[model samples]
Each structure stands twice: as C-alpha cells, then as structure tokens.
Target: MFARIFADRFVLLLLATILLASFIPVRGHAAEVASLISSAAIFLLFFLNGVRLPRHEVVSGVRNWQLQGAIFLFVFGVMSAAGLAMSHILDNILPPILALGLLFTGILPSTVQSAAAYCALARGNVAASVVAAALVNLVGVVLSPLLFALLAHVGEATVSGQAVGRIAIILLLPFALGQMAQRWCKPWVDAHKDLATWMDRISIAIAVYVAFSGAVVAGIWSIVRGDELAWLALAV
Candidate 1:
C-alpha cells in the first residue's frame, strides 16, 4: 500500500522540493529571483492550458449553470466557513498570521493550471475545470476580502493594486494571450502532450518551492513550536 501510494513521480518530486526549501531556503535578492521564475512558470502553465482547450468548449463550460453554481457555493460558502472555523479553533495555539492564513487560503480560488491539469489527468472535463477555476478566481478577487472583512472584522478591507496586478499578470493575462495565439500553438501543444504534462508538474513544484522557501527564510520553523506546527498541519 505504501509503495503504491509513493509510486507517483510527482509526489516524490514535491517531497524533494519541500526538503530543498527546508535546508537551502532562498533569501534576499535570490528569493525575489525565485519568485519571478515561479511566476513565469505559472504564466506559461496557464498559457498552455488556454492554447490546448477549445474556445467553444470554454463557452459551453461557462454555460453549465448547475455545475458552476455548485462549485461557486462550495468554494465561497463551504470552504470559507471551514476556514473560519479552523481559524477560531486554532486561534489559541497559532500565530495570528498563520491562523489567518488558513482563512485566506480557504477564501482563495483554485489555481487554473493545477486544477485543469489534474482534471485532464483524471480523464475529466478539462474545459469545465478551466472555466470553473477562472470564474471562481475572478469572483474571489472581490469576495475574499469581503469575507475577511465580515468575519474577521478587520476594520475596512483594502486591496492593493499591486496584488490585483500580480494576479492578472501571472494568472489571467497569460491565459488570455494564449487563447489569442491558440490557432497556431494548439497543434504543437497537442503533439507534445507529454511535455505539457511535465510543464504542469514542474510549475507546481517550483511554486511549492518558492512558497516554502519564503516561509523558511522568515524563520517559521524557529518561531512556530513543534506541537503548534503539528496541529497546524493537522488543521490544514
């Protein structure tokens, strides 16, 4: 059972990335470079997705009201509620930012590339997944902060232009550009399906590495106690 579970090459690579982040966490200017590289990988990831999926499929997926409605409620209502509950329960044990991070994560939408890649791998509707991911994230841009303000009561909620711009550049813009270039690019992507799959995994791993490297550099291990870390992991 253990061997079967560990058979996934992606999981092994993910573990390796986490281990690398723990030991050799990037810092200062180097960390910024890593972040930029990860962002580029993500941009490429979504762009490839846009190229591969058909426009007609995207349109039809968006019009699937029942499925989209269910996802909307689950992501916004259910996930947000769960995050809030976890935040309250773990409040005593965790640092404020860490506890709040749970809610922040919950309120956020699924990543376009990662979600669509998983759906495709599972032989599911990649078009629907892509549309769903994009739709929810677009809603999340407004809803996430509103939920935080309402539940956390953290004064007036403010979103920075830089944050929104980053999301647009990394997530939305590349996908849009790819859609425009899809006429020419789609054929190539279709031919190199395996390479595209690897791109998905590589981008995801780089993202994980950059994320954990930032945490490690910030002294998360030193600040968060062992028991607290365990509980945090469990809560997550």
Candidate 2:
C-alpha cells in the first residue's frame, strides 16, 4: 500500500521537494558537488533506461517517425508558448523575479520517466512516449537556449555556441555509451531489469532535489508565489 501511494504521488513529491529545497541554503562547494552528482545520476538513469528498454521495440518504432515527431513538436511548442505567455503576464502583475521563475519552468524539457509512466497508465504507446520525451530533451538543449536569446532578449553570452556544444557533449555522450554498453550486455540487463527501475526513480528524485537546491542558492523561492505555481501546473 505504501509503495502504491508513493508511485502515484512521485511527481508531487518531486515538486514539493524542489520547492522546499529552493528555500534552503548550501555552501558554494557543496552546491557544486551536488550539481555534479545530480548530473551524473541523471545520465546514469538515462543510460540504464537505454539498457532496460526492449531493444526490438526501440528498433521497430524507428518506422513510426510520425507519431514520435508529432508528440515531440507538440510538447515543445506548447510548453514554449505557454511559458512566454505566462511570463509576460506575470511580469505585468508580479515582480521581475517571479516572472523569471515562470521562464525557467518553461525552459525545461518534457521529463522522460513521467511521460512514459503516464502513457502506460493511459494505455498509450510507451515506446512512442520514450522517443518523444528523449527527443524533446535532445532538441531542447539547443532550441531552448536559442529561443531565450531570440525571444526573451537574453544575452548571447548565456547562449554561447561553446556552452551549447559542451551541454551536447554532457547530455549525448552518456546515452551513446549506455547504448553501446546495453548492446554488449543486453542479456545481463535483461536478467536484472528491476535494479534499473529503482535506479531511474532514485535518479529522478536526486535530480529534483538538486535543481531545487540550485534555485534556492540563486534565491528564487523568495519571489515565487502560490498562485503562479497553480497556474503553471494547470498550463502544464
């Protein structure tokens, strides 16, 4: 019963933890270490994800490009537009910092595990969900920063080509390695699939905590409001 309750409220727990962490301060070096650990954890989760997926399903869905592409575009476009609209509106009624909070919320890509789990619950295609969610993150790494530069009037310094290239390396190389590793150890990962699931969930929780902690370090909590969070939830 406890497990079932946690499963149902994982996203809520993540959001709550992120909010709480945003208000707590950490030392500078500890912050950097936490960020590094969080990034590694998320990458490992993604890689293990690559391993645990049925290879045949991923390969077979290569032919279903339309479904994947549609979902990807829809999620990206909708989220971006909603972010811009909300931020602009909030900027008028709220303070600058709170408006900025809305911007960051929109900048993040669609989450993979949540999307996949929700799709399965809704009796939709899990493979399609995985592909679409991954594609969102993969493309968002470039498109998101570019959008900020173009639409939000952010400085080129923040969206530098060098930075983007580094981010691409950080995000892609791990998945590539995981794919290769999974192919080599397919039988073993298949034999112990349950461990991969636990790792994925734990990594997500860690990522949430780390993100909120960074926001706290940056002093975002002081600006955000209950009303804005409610609107963001509805928009999402």
Candidate 3:
C-alpha cells in the first residue's frame, strides 16, 4: 500500500518539488520565468479540461443546483468561519501575515481540475465537481476581495477589472475555445485521456514549485516554526 501510494507520480513530483524549493528556491529572473511557465501550463490545463469535458455533462452539472449550493456554502460560509476561528487561535503563535494568509485561503474557490479529477477517480460525480468548482471560482472572483476587505480589514482593490480580464484570458477564453472545437477534438481527447491527466498533474506540480520557491525565497522557514507547521498539518 505504501509503494502503491508512492508510485503515484503526482505525489512523488510534489514531494520532490517541495524538497527542491527548500534547498534551491528560484529567484529573480528564474522565478519570473517559472511564473510564466506556470501560467501557461494553467491555461493549457484548463483548455484540455474543456476539451475533455462533455458538453452534455456540463449542462447537467450546471443544473444540479442543490449540489452546487452545498459546495458554495461549504467554501464561502463554513470554511470562512473556520478560517477566522483558526486565525484567532493561532494569532499568537503564527506571524500575522501567515494567519491572514490562512484566513484568505478559506475564502478562495474550490480547486477546479484537481477536484474534478479526484471525483472521477473516486467514482463520484465528476460533472458536478467541475461545475461546482467553476461556479465557486466565478463567485469568488467578486466575493473573495469583499470578504478579505471585511474580515482581514485589507484593501479591496485586488479584484479589479484588470483581474477579471486576466481571469477571462487565462481561464475562460481557452475553455471556451476548446469547447468550440470539442466536436473535432473529442476523439483524440478520449483516446488520450492519460495525456490530459498527466498535463493536469504537471501543471499543478509547476504551480506548487513556483509557490514554494517564492515562500522559501521570502524566508518562510525562518518565520514558521516546526511546531507551527505541525499544527498546520493537523489543521489542514
């Protein structure tokens, strides 16, 4: 069982990435390049997701209002409340910014591709996962900034028109284009589902690497104590 779990390439790659980032965090121009690559990989990941997702499934998924509503409530309401409670509990132990970051995470959307992929693997409702993830993100585009401003007392300028434009360009536009070409692309996509799965994993790995690299460069290890990380692990 241990070997089976470790044999999952994504898990191994993610662990390797965290270790690498701790030892040799990307900085300056290298970090910039990694950021760009991560962004491009995200676009490709979403595009492929669109190509693979059946239109009928999307339609049905959208119509599952009950499931979507539950997911939204969990993400925006319960999670946010929990984050606030945790932040207060950990404020004395954790850096203020780190506590705030934890709170901020609760207000974010459900992860899209990863959630859908996992749901499919678990023989659950993958279509609902896809729609719910997308809906949560769309709502979060507006709601997250407001929540941050209210709960964290932070400035609300983060979710501007420019941010929306970037989201549209990087996420929605590619998905839409892929959907438009789905009729012609479906066969190839179906035949090579593993390719799509690996692409998604690689994109996620790239994102994790870039994120951890930035954290390492910013002296995260120095700021966060081992006990704090242990607490974080339990909380997560």
Candidate 4:
C-alpha cells in the first residue's frame, strides 16, 4: 500500500521537499547557496519540459488553428469576465496588491497537465484538451497583458512589452525547443519513457520549492495573514 501510494503520488514528495527547504533557515553565505539551488531547480524544470515536449504532436496540432482559437477565446473570455466580477466584489475587502495578484492568477490560462488529466478522467478527448490548453497558455503569454491594459487600465506596472518578452523567453521558448528535440529523441523517449516521467516529477517539486523559498526569503510569507493564504488556496 505504501509503495503504491508513493508510485501514484511522487509529485507530492517533491512538493514536501520544497516546503522543507523553504523552512530551513540559512545564514549569509548559506542563504545564497539555498537561493542558487532553488533557481537551478526552477531552470531544470523548464529544461526538462523542453527536452520532453513531443515535436510531432505539437507540429500536427499547429494545423488545427480553429480548435486552438476556440480554446484561446474561451479561456480569455471566461477569465476576463471572472476577474472583472471578482474585482468588483472584493475591491473594498482585499488590499490592492493582493487583489491584483488574484486578478493576475485568473488572467493566467488553464494549466495543460491538469486540464488533460481532467479530460482523460471524463473519457473526453485528451489530445484535444492538451493541445487546447497549450494553445491557451501560449496565446495568454501575449493576450493577457493586452487585456489587462485595456480593461483594468493597468499601465506599465501590470502589463508591459518587457513582461511579455520575458515570459515568452522563459516559458514558450522551452516548449518550442522541446518540440524541436522531440523528433530527434522520439525513439529514445519511447524506449526509456522513465526519463520523461522523472523529469516531470522533479520539475514540479523544484517549482513548488522555488516558489515557497522565494516567498520565505523575501518575507512575503510573513506579511500575508493566515486567512489570506486560506483564501488564495481556495481561490486556486
């Protein structure tokens, strides 16, 4: 039973590692090492994603512009409407910065992994779901800032060309590179699928750790109240 549980939930273990890392107090030089480790882990995740992305699959889906457009429009419309409505309701209650964070969260597109998992569980089209989610995120990399600027009057602070470029560099470039590598690595990826599997598990763990550790080091965790954390957790 224990073995099966671990087999099914390896990602959670990585998350635990990250959380533990975040709590480990470090002095001057040690803190720098910790920060470096966290940054390395985050980059490793993106690198792994790039290495694992299936080029043929992504290329084939590129022709399905109609489906991609539908997904992009749906995500943009729903998130935009939801953000506006939530902002109106919570404008007086939540602090502006927190509120902006919440809005930013909603502005983000649906995560590809979760959306694909849900589609599989529902016996829906997993391929379509994966492609759709990917397209939404890709488009959101640009459209999000534009919508924020237009609807929220979010100036240079909330949405900027630089932000779009940075996001594209960090996220989209990895995905594109992964796709390009997929063809060359197809046979090996098939023969040793465990490599991709491990990369996925490790990447998620690193991400959670880096996020929590960064927050802890910056003292942002202390400023936020327990109730606010609870709310954000629930909101997500």
Residue-level lDDT of model 1, residues 1-236, one tens digit each, is 78976898878999999999999998899989998898889888889988987898888998999999999999999999999999988888888888988888788778776787778767799888988888887777778888888888787877666766777788778888888999899999999998778888998889889889998988888998999889899999
Give each model's whole-structure lDDT.
0.86, 0.66, 0.81, 0.62
lDDT of 1: 0.86
Cα lDDT for residue 48, candidate 2: 65
Q: Which candidate is the best by lDDT?
A: 1
Query: Candidate 1: lDDT of 187?
Result: 93
The root-mean-square deviation over C-alpha atoms between each candidate and the true structure, in angstroms, is 2.0, 4.3, 2.4, 5.2
Model 4 misses residue 30 by how many Å?
8.2
lDDT of candidate 3 at residue 22, scale 0 to 100: 93
lDDT of 3 by residue, 120-159 (tens): 5566776678678877887788998899789988665466
> Against the true structure, what is each candidate's TM-score?
0.90, 0.72, 0.88, 0.68
User: For model 3, what is the alpha-carbon lDDT of residue 219?
Assistant: 92
lDDT of model 2 at position 199? 63
The sequence of per-residue lDDT tens digits that candidate 4 reaches over residues 1-236 is: 76766665664576577668667735457667765664454444344445554555556666678877777766788777787777666666666777676677667786554554445435565445656776676667678877777667767534356755754665456556655776676566668756655554554555455556666777867787888767656654
What lDDT would candidate 2 get against the real structure? 0.66
> Quick one: RMSD of model 2?
4.3
**Candidate 3 structure, TM-score to reference:** 0.88
Considering lDDT, where higher is better, how would the candidates rank from best to worst? Answer: 1, 3, 2, 4
